[model samples]
Target: QKEVEQDPGPLSVPEGAIVSLNCTYSNSAFQYFMWYRQYSRKGPELLMYTYSSGNKEDGRFTAQVDKSSKYISLFIRDSQPSDSATYLCAMSEASWGKLQFGAGTQVVVTP
Candidate 1:
């Protein structure tokens, strides 16, 4: 099985909708959980990052990690058309650098 699994969703929603994206992992050694947003033709940018298990929120983005369940989630509140992009979930055993990423969920927010 893949170390990390995420629904490669071409998830579509209207503007102002709350979107939820998730990922599950098989590795218990992972210590860092991250969510990255990538626009077309651009590199992924870090949206959220957490160590071990906890919740982190910034603006309309929230990230949660459950080490015991080996799951992680990202929630976007009031999603906008500008938010349309591919969301990637990542995890790593180290502090930084290398990380295993999910297949990525494509989200399109329409007006």
Candidate 2:
């Protein structure tokens, strides 16, 4: 188990909405954020990445990066059942640095 607790999930959401997903860690040295979504047996696909601190948005997805708080978040808007997957959070010292994973969160977007 990790101190990384994802809220409103291992989650279930209706086809088009959900609260933000959060992740917290103890490593203050981490400087990069990576979010990935993996389907039942498929390889994980990278969703987004953020540097030290700030928010980044791509389409309906938003990533909030706060290094000072040792926190990061991924928000999915207008979710679809296809959004249902095992989501993974990773942190690194640099963009290509060694990756450390969070405990992982699974989300279900219901139809």
Give the clash count for each candidate.
0, 0
TM-score of 1: 0.96
**Which candidate achieves the best lDDT against the true structure?**
1
TM-score of each: 0.96, 0.89
lDDT of each: 0.95, 0.83
Report the C-alpha lDDT of model 2 over 26-90, residue by residue, as the tens digit.
87888888898888889989999888899999998999998888889999999998899988888
| Model 2 alpha-carbon miss at residue 5, Å | 5.4
lDDT of 2 at 100: 83
Tell me how candidate 1 scores on lDDT: 0.95
- Lowest summed lDDT across 10 adjacent residues in model 2 is found at 1-10
lDDT of prediction 2: 0.83
